[model samples]
Target: MIRRISAALLALGLATAAFAQAAWTDAEVRKVDAKTGKITLKHGEIKNLDMPPMTMVFTAKDKALLEGVKAGDHVQFAADKDAAGEYVLTAIQQKK
Candidate 1:
């Protein structure tokens, strides 16, 4: 019983760690191309992607992700590599 409880606690901790790994990253929108579903960002470190701060363009996972976002907006976002190994914006929101 004690071993089972310990295992459950360990699993819970691992789950929390995984969730934290997907935390939002800070960025400033440099450009937005709604027609192409792509946006350029000058961003801080993207921890999940193991990337350093840089300005680059990324395709949004969905064109709707570009809605209400515009160039020069300060934002927080999350990105992940797609099947083709290209970074795709998964989520984004303008900073308040």
Candidate 2:
């Protein structure tokens, strides 16, 4: 019974680790509005939110997140809904 419990715990830990890794989605910056801390993205599946591919605007968690990136740049980003029920850009990185 002890061995079975240990195995279960190990499995649970691995599952948690996998889930903790944010599933980034491919996107292209369609627009950026620094004043409003929002960016428009044409993106593929956002796995964390179960959202299908689409083009939409998202508020960045911080306006500075838009720095060094601009319209037409291919990027990878992660987004999630904030407590205010607004979609917030959590991570963004330009694609090489």
Which candidate comes out best when scored by lDDT? 1
Report the error of model 2 at residue 33, Å: 0.6
TM-score of 1: 0.78
Q: Superposing every Cα of model 1 onto the true structure, what RMSD results? A: 3.6
The residue pairs in collision within model 2 are none
lDDT of 2: 0.92
Model 1, range 1-96, lDDT digits (tens) per residue?
A: 999999999999999998676669999999999999999999999987899999999999999999999998999999999999999999998887
Considering summed lDDT, which 10 consecutive residues are worst modelled in model 2?
A: 16-25
Tell me the whole-model lDDT of each prediction, alpha carbons only: 0.94, 0.92
Model 1 C-alpha lDDT versus the unseen true structure: 0.94
Q: In order, how many clashes per candidate?
A: 0, 0
Candidate 1 lDDT for residue 27: 98
